[model samples]
Target: MGSIHHLIGDLPHRSLHDLSRRYGPVMLLKFGQVPFIIVSSPEAAKDIMKTHDSIFAMRPQSEIMKIITKRGQGLVFAPYDDQWRQLRKICIRELLCAKRVQSFCAIREEEAARLVKSISSDQAHLVNLSKKLADYATDAAIRIITGTRFENQE
Candidate 1:
């Protein structure tokens, strides 16, 4: 019986680190129905990621991911294959090209300015910098890609 319940209320990664300190650098954690092997040591991590990359390169697939991906139509969760390779090339050339990335610079600068102004306005108060940066990044990306900022109330 794994102590998965002990990690339920806390951030999973932080919990894993605590458990690894108590257990060992390498530990097995079972989260409800999912079992995960936690590797904390640099040597062990390198062994798994570099020496055995092919065996662990793909992410675990779930029903929700399959539905969202339309059975591997997009790049995010597509399996490593000829189709994924072609899709990656198209994405790099069309979506992430130099010209396309440069086009988003103005939107990024504007969002960054807004973020700086918001932060400067409340320097005396404790600010959630992480959340603020994440929100700014999301707004900038959406505005650049879709030509509109996401309306929170919509």
Candidate 2:
């Protein structure tokens, strides 16, 4: 209650924890567009998950997630409705099967080679590992999805 408002605005963990320490464990913080009530107690969780779970079922979709989902084109990004289930059918069966993956060991080898080459060739002592990994992953995922490379970051 002291400065819970100042501590957390977007991510409410700090403020919620502070309040729970001040008050009881089950701290209800009614703020922002969504009313976020942080329940630290196991007793409160039993009620929330067991009793009021359905009422809190199906998380509210975020705008950024929706946009990055390409309006729901990605197989993983799609909701767990009929379309997602339908799309995931082939991905589960043929695309990601153990045999299929083992057969495509060459692909993994190639990607590993790419990463190794990048690291070796870089003059900079500290490379942006995240960006480098992102480049490799994006290339691999795009190739898997479309059978085409958008751009070679190399």
Candidate 3:
């Protein structure tokens, strides 16, 4: 609880901004028992993420994350190790490559058109634009992954 007392009431971002203004862009803080390095500035964030990334590459694993990821089997939760490196390489080469992403352009366009049609079709009622956009995103992702449209989007 080193700096938790100073962060009460006000929004966390605002508190952090004030603290950073006084303490500098990068500061170490303790919440309960965990030590967190708060990086507020883009330059500091870039330095930490790009230059010193290896030092911070291993994420703090939680019980829930362990259960959800089957003991860090996936890239997102896995420790920075051989397995994580392999998974990252595979993701870059397969799922996130330029060619693979370009291949999904048609699906994205189709989904956008469908979303527009859906929104315009029910002009009589007030549209829940947020829900519709979320559905559109889900539909597009499903189409990209399964090569088929999601049914019952309503």
The top-ranked prediction according to lDDT is: 3
Better of 1 and 2 by TM-score: 1
Report every candidate's CA lDDT.
Answer: 0.84, 0.73, 0.91
Q: In model 1, which runs have C-alpha deviations exceeding 4 angstroms? A: 1-29, 151-154
Q: Estimated TM-score per prediction? A: 0.75, 0.60, 0.71
- Candidate 3 ranges with C-alpha deviation above 4 Å: 9-18, 32-35, 97-106, 122-131, 152-154
lDDT of 1 by residue, 1-154 (tens): 4657867765877877888889888887777678788899898899888998877766778899888888867787888778888998999999999998998899999999988998999989999999889889888988987898785442
lDDT of 2 at 50: 97
List, residue by residue over 58-140, the lDDT tens digit for candidate 2.
Answer: 44568888887776676766665678778889788988899977875766677768888988898768899899888888877
* TM-score quality measure for candidate 1: 0.75
In candidate 3 the C-alpha lDDT for residue 109 amounts to 95
What value does the lDDT take at residue 97 in candidate 2?
92
Sorting all predicted structures by lDDT, with the top scorer first, yields 3, 1, 2
Q: Quote the lDDT for 148 in model 3.
A: 85
True lDDT of residue 68, candidate 2: 79
Please report the candidate that would top TM-score against the real structure. Answer: 1
Q: Could you tell which candidate, 1 or 2, scores higher by lDDT?
A: 1
